[model samples]
Target: MLGRTAATPVNGHSANNNPNQLALPVNLPPGQQSEASIVHQHIQEISNKRISTLDYLRKAHEGRVYWFNTLLFDKSDLARMPYFDSRRLARRATNHLFLGLSLPSVIDVGSCTPLEFLRSLNILLSEYDAFQQLHAEHGSASSSLSRARLPQMFRRSAPGSKVRRTSNAAEVGYPHDGGDGGGANGTHNNSETTAGSTLGGGGGGGGGNGAAAGSAAATASAISLAASETELLPGEEYTHLLTPSIPFEPDYFETFATLCDVLIDTYQRLLTLVPTPRECAGNGVAELFTKADGKLRKIIIQGTVKEFEDASRQGVKTEVANVAKVVLGGLIST
Candidate 1:
C-alpha cells in the first residue's frame, strides 16, 4: 500500500470527503481572544431587551401625543389617516386599544386593559373610603366641643338675642358649664391632670400601663374637645395637633397620608404621558375620533388631567389634594 502523506485522511478519503475528519484548529493571540470575547459580550448585551412599565407607558403616550400633535398642524392629512371611535382609546392600554391588537406607533399601546383600570380604580376607591372613615372619626372626635358649642353659637347669633358678642361672653365663650369661670377652670385642671397622667405614667406596671392608656385616650378626647371649643376646626391645624401632640397609637391620620401618597404616585405616573414641548409642536394628519355625543367626530386635547390637578390643589392641606388625584389615583397605582 502507498504511504499516506500529511495532507491525506486517516481512512483513504480526502479530508473534505471524510465525515470523521476534523478541521484544523487556528490559535488566536491573547489580545485577539480578549477582543473577540468583548465583541461577543456586546452582541449578547445588544440582544437582551427589557423595558419598565413606566418607560413603556411613556413611549406609548409619546407616540400618541406625537401623532396627535402632527395631526393638529395639518388639515388635508386627515384623508390619509385611519378613523376610529374615541371610546376605543385606552390611555394606559397597549397601543391604546380598548379591545384590539396594536395599530401603529402613534395609535398602538402596550399591554394594559380595562380590567387593569378597574382594578386600579377599586384600590383607590377603597383607600379613599378608608380615608373618609378615618377622617370622619378624627373630625367627629375632635369636633365634639365645636358641636357642643353650636347651641351657644346659634343662640348668640340669633336675631335680637341678649347674648353679648364679646369673645369672652359667658353665653358664647364658656358655654360648657353655664359660663361659670370656676367650672371652666375646674374642667381645665381636670384635663391637665388627665394629660399629665397619660404622659408621665409611662414607667408603670401592667395595670398602670392600662390606666395610662385609658388616660391617654381621655386626654385626647378632652384636648380635642377643648380645641373644638376654641373653634379649631378639622383642618391642618387640627391634623398638626393630632400628629405630635397626640401619639398616633391608632395610626393617626395614616389613611389620609396614604391617600396623599397614592395621589402623588398616580400624578407622577400620569406625568409620563405629558408630551415633551418638542413633541407638542409637531404636525400630522388625524383620523382618530371619540364617540359621537357633542361635536364632529375627532380627538381633541381638551382639559387634561394636568388641568384638573392644577385646579384641585387650591384648598386645605389636610383635605383632598385634587380631583385628578382622587379619580386618577383610583385608576392606576404605577
Candidate 2:
C-alpha cells in the first residue's frame, strides 16, 4: 500500500504485492466517472486526433510553402497537383506570394501558410500559360481561314458601266444635209460654209456627224474608266455595307463577335471582384482579411480578363496584318 493510489487498475488489483487485493474506491467529481461509465470516450478522443491530422494534411496540400519547401528543400510531391484545372487556387497562391514580397505594409501573412500560397501560384501560372497557347493557336488558325476565304470577298464591278449618258439631242444638234452648205431654213449659209471650209470644205452636216461620233467615243471611254474604278476600298463604309447589305458570311461575323464577347464578358466578371477604394485601407485582423480577400479577387479577375482582351486584340491585329499578305499573294498568283 506504500505507493498505491485509489485508481482502478487494468487487472482490478492494487499494487500492494497481493494478487487478490482489490483497488480502493476513488473520490469522483459531479461529472467524473469510471472508464467503463464513459462509453466510447477513448474512441471519441482518437477520432478527434485523426480529424486534426487530416486538417493539417489538407492545409499542407493546399499551401504555397509546401510547394516551395518541397522544391527547395525536401524534393517531395510538389508536382503531383493537377495545375491546369486547379487554376483558381493557384491564382490565389500567386497573389499571396507577390503580396508577401512586394507590399511594405504586409509584414507577415498571418495564418495564411506559405506552402498553400505557393501551390496556388503554380496552378495559376500553369493556367495562364495554357490560355496563352490556346489564344495563339486560335489566332493563327483564324488568320489562315480568313486569308483562305478573302478571294471570294472581292467585289465584282456593278452589272453595267456607271457613266452618265449624254442626250441624243446634244449629239444631233446640227442638220445632216449633203456636203453642199445649207442652213436649217433651207437657205444658203455663208457662216456655215466658212466653218466647213476650215475643215477642208467638208459640209456642215459632215462636221455635225463627226462631232457626234467623237462624243459617243468619249462617252464609251468614260464608262470604261468608271467601271474599272468602282470597287470599294476596305473601310468603315465598306464594312457597314458588307455587314448587312451583302451576303452574310457566318465565318466572318462569328469570329469577330466571339472575340468581342470574350473581352466584354471578362471585363464584366472582373469588375465584380475589384474592391472599392475605401475597402483597401483598414487595421483589424478581420478587416485585413476582408481587404486581402477583396484584393486577391480583384487581382485574379483583372489578370484573367486582361489576358483574354489582350489575346483577342492581338488576334485582330494579326488578322489585319495578314490581309496585305493575302492580297499580295493573290496579285502574284493572278
Candidate 3:
C-alpha cells in the first residue's frame, strides 16, 4: 500500500536523530501540581454549593406545597365556618406576600437564570392551581345565597315585631300645604299629630321606654358574661388561631427536618472540598472560595429558618421559640 506509507518513522522524528534526542514529557513541579489540585478543589466546592442551592430551592418549593395541603386542602370542615373562610383568605394573602418577598432573595443567592426562574414560578403557579381547586370545592356560597334572599327580605314588614317602620315625614315634622291637612275622609289629615299628642308627645312612649331599659340591661349582662368568659377579644382569638400550635403538623415537620439534614450533609461535604486561602491564591480559585463561603452562610440561615418553620407547624413551639431567639441573637450581635 504505497510502500507501507514510506515505512513511517518510529517516533515521528528524523531517522538521523538518536532515540535519546527525542523531547521528554514535561513534568509539573510539586507547587504547580498543588496549585492545580487547589483549583480543582475550589471548582468542586463551587459546584457542590450550586447543587446544594438547587436542593434547598427544591425542598423549599416542596415544603410550600405540603404547607398548602396541610393548612388549606386538608380541612374539609373549614368551609362551614364564616370566620374560617375569612381567615383562609387572609392566610392566603399573607402567604403570597411572604413568598413573593422571599422568592427573589432565594433566586438572587442561587443566581438562577431567567428560564430557571420562570420554571420555578411555573411550579408555584401549578401548586396555586391545586390550592384554588381545594378552595373552590370547599368555599361557602353564602354571598350568592344571601343575594338571592335580598328582594323579599328587604320588603317592608307588616306592623309587628322588632324593627318598626315609620315615615320620615312623621318622624320629623314636614309642612303640609293643603288646607285642613285632610284627605277624602272627614277626619283630620293630622293622624300622625293626633297619635303623637295622645301619647303626651311620645308616639310609642311606654313600649319604647321599656325596650330601651331592657336593651341596656341585656347589654350590661352581655358585657359581664363576656368579661367573665375570657379576657381575650374576638380579634385576639383570631390572632391566636393564626399562631401555629406546637407539634402542629408532625408529617410536615418530619419532611422539612429531613431537608435540613440533607442541607447539613451537603454543607459538610462542600466544606471538605473547599480550598484553603493559600491554595486559592496560587490557582486563581480565591473568587470561588469567597462565593462558596457566601452561599454556605446563606444556606445555613435559610435552612435554620425552614427547620423552625417546620417545627412550628408541628406544634414544636419550644424549637420555634429557640430559633426565634437565635435569629434575635444574630441580629443583636450583628
Candidate 4:
C-alpha cells in the first residue's frame, strides 16, 4: 500500500486507453491464465507505477523491430520486402527473449530448477526439428511464411549486413569446432543410436528330456546376443545429443523467426528465481523480471561493429541509425 501511494500515474494516451491501468491484475479472458502475465501483474501491484510486462514488451518490441528492420531487409528482394516493412520479426524475437528469461505458466518462478531448464531446452530442440522440416518442404519462398518464422538472423556484426546462424542453432558459426557434442542435460545428439538384438532356437531335440535342455540353451544364447547389442562407455549416456547439420535456406532470417516462436513458448514456461530487488516488493516468484521487461538484449549476436563491417556492406550506416534510435527511443539522428 505504501509503494502504491508513492507511485505516480503516467497520463499519456498509452495509459488512458487501458481500463486496467489502475487494477492490480489485468483481468484475464474467459478461463485463460498466463504465468508471465501474472508476474507482470505483481510488478505493477508493487511498483505503484503503471508497469505491465505486456505493455513493456510492446514498447520493447517496437524498438527491437525498428532496429532489426533497419539493419536487415533486402531492398531488391520483393518477397522479403513486405516482411521487412512489417517488423513482425522483431516482436517475435523479443517474445522469445522474454519467455526464455521468465517463469513458466503452471509453475511459479521460484520453482525453476536445473531440470526445468533441460525441459525447456528439449521443447526448443523439438521446435528446431519442426522448423527444419518446414523449410525443407517449402523453403522460405513459401508465400504463407512470416518473417518471424525464419531460420537465421541478421546479426549486428559481420562482413556487410548478411544474416547469420543464431546461438540456438547447433552450428552457429558455420564451421563448427566439434571437439565435444552437447554435454548439457538438454537433449540427445545428432544420432539416437538405439541398439537391439534377437535370439534363435533350434528344434533338433526329439524327446522330452533333450527338448527342455535344448530350449534352455537356446534361451541363454539369445540373452547373450541381446546384451552385446549396444554397450555405451561410462558417462556417455547423457553426453550424446543429435545435433542436426541442416543447411539454411537463402531466407534463413525468416526461418529463425518461426523457430524462435517454439523457443518462446518453451522458455516462457520456465521460472528462474533470483533474490528480490529492494525497490520492488518480493513477488515471491523468482523470475528475472528485468530480463523479461528490457528490450534489445539480443542473444544471437557477437563481435564489434568495426570487426564485422566490410567494404561491401551498404546497410551499416542505417544499422547504426537504428541502434541510436533504440538508445534514444526515436530522439536523434546522429
Candidate 5:
C-alpha cells in the first residue's frame, strides 16, 4: 500500500473519489492504424474536401451568369426574355453538366450486379409505362388538370418562377440504329425455324402411331406449339415484363422516361457486345461496369442531353430531372 502513488485530483473530484471505479489512463496511447485504415482516412479527407469545394462553388455562383460563348454574339433584345435570359441559360448549362457528372452517385452502376441492374431497370420501366399512360389520359389541353393533380411537394414552383408555364412536348431522339434489334442474339432469329422443323418431324411420325399414342402425340404437339409462340430466349426475357400502372406524380414522369432510356440503351449495347451464349456467360456481368468511352460514350451522352431537352420542354421537375441526368451519365460512364 505504501508503494502505490496517490490519486491526483482533477477539478473537484479525485481519481480515488470512486473506489469501485477502475481508473483510466490519463494519456492513452493512440491506436495503431493499419495501411487500409490510413488509406481510408486519406480518402475520407479527400472526399470531404471535394464536397466542401463543390458546396462553396454552388453558393458562390448560385445566381451568377457564366459567359460560355458571349464574345461570339452580342446581348440582344431576346436576352431580356425570361427563357433567353443570360442567367437562366447559364444555370441550365451548369445544371446539365452537373447532371451528367452526378450519375455515378445517382445509380452506382459500377457496384451493381447484372441481376440487380435488371431488377432496378424493371422498376423504372414500369414507372415509365405508367407515366406514359397518365400523360395520355390526363395531360391533354381539354383535361381540366392543373396543379391539383401534382403532389404537395411539387405543386408549387420555386420562387421567381411562373406558377403555370406552357409546356410543349418535344421530340426525344431515341437510339434507332437498325442493326441494334437483337439480331445478333442468333437464338431469337432461329427459334421459328427450329420450331417449324420440330413440328414437321413430329407430324410425320404421328400418322404411324396407334389411337392412344396418337392422342398423346397430338397433346404434346399442342403444348410445343404454344411454347413456340410464347417462349423468349435468355436475356430477351425483359420483353415479356408486364408494365403495370404505378401511380407517380407528373414531376417524376420525365425522370422515369430518362432512366428507361439509359437502361434500354445500355442493355441494347450489351446485347451487341455479347452475341453468343458462351461469350455472354463470361462477359455479360463484367462488361456492364466497363468504362464506356470513344464513340459509344459520345452517343450515350448525346441521348442523355436529348432527354433533358425533351424534359425541359415538357415541364420537367427540376429536382427529379437533375437526379435522372446524374443516373444516365453514371450508367454511360460505368
Candidate 6:
C-alpha cells in the first residue's frame, strides 16, 4: 500500500495552512523581502491577487458620510437637544468604518454599493420633519435642556395684536433678525412695555413706586424663567424664545454643546484608531474567508478610506491606474 508523503494534501489546500501562514517565509511568493512583517507578507499576497480594495474603502466611507452629511443639514434635527451638524462631525463616521474593517495593507470590499446622493437628500428632509414634530409634542423635554418644566418663554405679543402663543419655530413668524438677536436691555424694555400696557395700562391712580417696582419685578421674573438670549412672544403653547436657526452649527455656540460633544467623542475615537499612510501601505492584495460560503474573499488596498470619501463627495472621478505605487509608498490618492 502506498503511504501518504509530506507533499500529500488532506484537502485541496496545502496541509501546511495555519493562521500564522503569513509569518512563514516559504509560503510567501517571490518579491517579498525575507525580513517581511505580517503586514509586508500580506502586501505581497495582495500584489499577487490584484484586488481593488481602494474602491471598496472609498465607497464605504462615502456611504457613511452621505448619511452623516445629511444629518448635518441645518436645523435638520433642531428640536433634539445636543443637535450636531458639521463637516468635522461627519469625519467620525468616515474614520470609524475604515478602522473597524481590519485595515491591513490590502482591502477586499467583496461586494457593496457606495452611498447614493439622492438618499442623502431624502434623509435630510425626513429627519428635519421628524425632529420638529417631536418638539411640537414634547417641547424642551426632547431638547438637551433639562426637564425644568420651564414655563414657555416667548416674545410678548403686543396688546390688541394677535395674542396667539407663537412658537419659536417658523409658522410663528418669519426668521428673527439675522443674528442671535437677543440683548438684556432690549429684553427688559420690551417685557416692561408689554406688561405695564397689557395689565395696568389705565389703572394710573397713584402707584408710582408701586407700578415701577411691580414692573421691574415682573421683568426680572420673566428673564429668569426664560434665558435672555431672545425676546419671547406670548403664545398659547407657551413657546420658548426662538432664536435664528442656521444650516450649520458653528464651532463656538454653547447651546449645541451636548451635540458637539457627541461628535467630538465619536471623532476622537476614530482619530485614535486611524492608520497612518505608511502603516496602511500594502504590497498588493489578500484573501479573507467569507462567512456566507466559507470561501476566500479577496481584499485589496487602492487608497485610504478618507481619500476615497473626499473624492466621492466632491464628485471627482478616481482613476485607478498606478494605484499600487500610491498604496505601497506614494501619497494616497485624494
Which candidate number maximizes lDDT?
A: 3
Best by TM-score: 4
- Local distance difference test, candidate 4: 0.31
Q: What digit string (tens of lDDT, one per residue) describes model 4 on residues 149-247?
A: 433321111211222222223224322222133122122121110101112211111113334434444543323221111112222122112222222
**After aligning candidate 6 to the native by TM-score, how far in Å is the CA of 107 from where it should be?**
28
lDDT of each: 0.27, 0.31, 0.36, 0.31, 0.32, 0.29
TM-score of each: 0.20, 0.16, 0.23, 0.23, 0.19, 0.18
Sorting all predicted structures by lDDT, with the top scorer first, yields 3, 5, 2, 4, 6, 1
What value does the lDDT take at residue 48 in candidate 6?
A: 33
lDDT of 6 at 29: 42
Q: Rank the candidates by TM-score, best first.
A: 4, 3, 1, 5, 6, 2
Q: Which lDDT tens digits does candidate 6 get at residues 70-119?
A: 22212332222232234323322222222232221111221110111112
Clashes of each: 12, 13, 10, 27, 1, 24
- List runs of model 2 lying over 4 Å from the truth: 1-297
**RMSD over all Cα atoms, model 3:** 25.5
Tens-digit lDDT string for candidate 3 (265-328): 5435434433332223243344444543454444334544464355436544555778899999
Alpha-carbon RMSD, each predicted model = 26.2, 32.7, 25.5, 21.6, 26.2, 21.1
User: Which candidate, 1 or 4, would have the higher TM-score against the true structure?
Assistant: 4
**Which stretches of model 3 miss by more than 4 angstroms?**
1-27, 64-283, 299-334
Q: Model 5, stretches more than 4 Å misplaced? A: 1-33, 63-98, 101-169, 172-334
